[model samples]
Target chain A: MTTMMLVPGFDRVVELVPGERAVAIRNIPATLPVFATHFARFPVLPGVLLLESMADLAKAALGDGHWRLRTVRGVRFRHFVGPGDQVEIRVEVTGRTDQTAQVRATARVEERVVATARGLALVAAEQPWEGTQ
Target chain B: MRFHLIDRIESWTPREQITARKVTSVAEDCWRPTPAGPVLSFGLALEALCQSATWLMMLSTDYRLRAALLAVDEACAPRDVVPGDVLRTHAVVESMSDEAAVLAGLVTVGGETVLEASGILCSLMDAERLDDPADTALMGRQLLGKGAPR
Candidate 1:
């Protein structure tokens, strides 16, 4: 693949339940260079990255290249996930159509729900921006 | 880790509103390149919006508290953003409280809307302890167009 940029995709796809759902894990490194620049004294995983991880897991659950992330909604961060923390993502397909899929995803560190989000993924071939951008 | 997504602030009004820009360049930090042209990742675009919201929170609170992105109620980017395109974002305060605030905004290239979002940002603790003074001062100078911060 194109080496899933920024925050380096998920560490591994721990489990995949076909089109229904997937679970993945990523261990945040304390030495991540961004942490040094994000804040000199204190650092926390960027909230957007938390959402991105969820999206990646959702995509994994979908399987194949037929789908790609399109929109993210109702995502909320309940706690700060920092360096050395292990983020476990669980994504479930809430609904689907001929060309699109809706997923509800959550990220937890240990037993605490750190973040949650709902998103839509469009089939690669049918995505609005396919080849006409 | 320290990639500053928003290039600069074009305009500002303390807590009420603000406008910023991100200049896409070939040397930009990205995870991968594609044949589809300058595709600003959805995550990066979302972070840009969140940065603007954070700015509003900073100004509105008189720099007393640092704001963290809490939630995105809704968001969409209808088109792909390519190189040489300047992203102009305008964010406004929808509502506010001591603990958190609602922000609404859009990202446009030229005159076409590329992305739109509404979200919430929260002030969790004292800004003094959470923010780097130099970075904070730099942002202030940029918003006021005082060159490259002191």
Candidate 2:
């Protein structure tokens, strides 16, 4: 596989300017191997990919720390991010308390909001046994 | 090809019980290395369990599976989803109608509840035209070298 094709779910780290805001983008290329089987005419990016994009954005917003989601309710899919459309996703760390942090994120198609998610991030003592496999 | 997502579900038999499982590994992008060193993303674990439950529920039906996750209520993740953790998901179909099924899923690790979710899903088309030529032909290539579940 070429280095270009190695990014399975993510395409490129488009724009990351500092402070708590970043604009990251990924494309659902029709030629992708998953598209070959994910679906036929009405192919769409899996919700899991949406979550991943959100999480990766969180990772950037939260430069260094361990945060896990306690809840992510009401994640609505207003529209589908398909092969031809470019998913311009943005995430901003809206608020932060001692133990809890709130993030506001959105997936946009140039001007319209394709999807949006309000995520909760918490800071806790790192786990003892993490990746054992 | 068999759907690995729903492979374990073989019985079409319906009861008051249903079972599913989700395993988080390195490849799933849930694990990360911290200076304090690696952590598991609990959110991913919850989503996996939800997907597993969805796979089982959809497999029980004979419609064109175009399940859309409408909502996730009462989500709680208390601990990190470590690699060894096996999320044994259990969903008792609380309610069902002609088009949708509401499932209550519980994610457990070491036989302990780590997360719980109430999810809603729906099928695309009716059973009779489930294999319509246009539909099958379009969704067929994706299932190349594979057949429908019995």
Candidate 3:
């Protein structure tokens, strides 16, 4: 499977400015298995899943699926994302080097921001895992 | 497919700290296939750390409260966790109140640190609101090995 296909919560890339910025979306489905146990009575998308969405977008913005999340700084979740919500994710490259890229990311539902990561660093994997699976 | 990340609670000191373990397996849904091998996803590693911290907060509150992770001030992973690796997580309370708690956590494999996280903030709510108190108690018992093994 392609790296984008392996991204846990991402649906598709809506826009991409390679190595600069990117926007993606994920549609939360009620039938997702995680909801069954995250809270049987009340299901909300796990915060870590939201972070994964951001990391996926960060990798897209960096123009390399081989990039792996290395560090996270100042990530916060302000609102809950429930089933049927369409999360709009965006990532912008803040810094870059031959082996690493630093990014800032956000997730939103409509116009309200639900999550933000002030600093995320992605480092190239020693061996590109893509096309090998 | 179970959302409970940590497999077992090794030790806990009420309001002070907690230690837990998770044995990675190829069957996990979070496994990412790589040329090197299948490795646990970074997000799952963070979730395990958060769960460990949440367990400490819950035990400290006597199971009266449930914790929802609100912020991760800092986190870093130095190595990938692969199948058959036993992840040992240690979480310590930094500051706490009736509404929220801040903690620092680390994950190690065979005495070597694999991941480190600090300034984790979680919001506290009445446990009964999100989960049945009876079920929570039962799960706590099982995790701490005070109840029959599954």
In terms of TM-score, which candidate is strongest? 3
Steric overlap count per candidate: 3, 3, 0
Model 2 clashing residue pairs (backbone): B1-B146, B34-B37, B34-B38
DockQ of 2: 0.25
Off by over 4 Å in 2: A1-19, A31-33, A40-42, A124-133, B1-3, B10-17, B22-44, B63-66, B119-150
lDDT of each: 0.73, 0.56, 0.85
Give candidate 2's TM-score. Answer: 0.70
Tens digit per residue, CA lDDT, model 3, B73-141: 999988888877899999999888989999999999889777899999999878777777778778888
lDDT of 3 by residue, A40-122 (tens): 76788899989988987787678765777879999999999999999999899999998889999999999799999999988
Query: Which of 2 and 3 is the better model by lDDT?
Result: 3
Chain A TM-score, cand. 1: 0.82
* Maximum-DockQ candidate: 3
Summarize candidate 1's per-residue lDDT along B84-131 as a digit string, tens digits.
677888888877777777888888888788788877555545677766
lDDT of 2 by residue, B52-97 (tens): 5554444455333534555454466665566556666666666665
Give, for candidate 2 chain A, the lowest lDDT window spanning 10 residues: A1-10
Quote the lDDT for B49 in model 1: 72
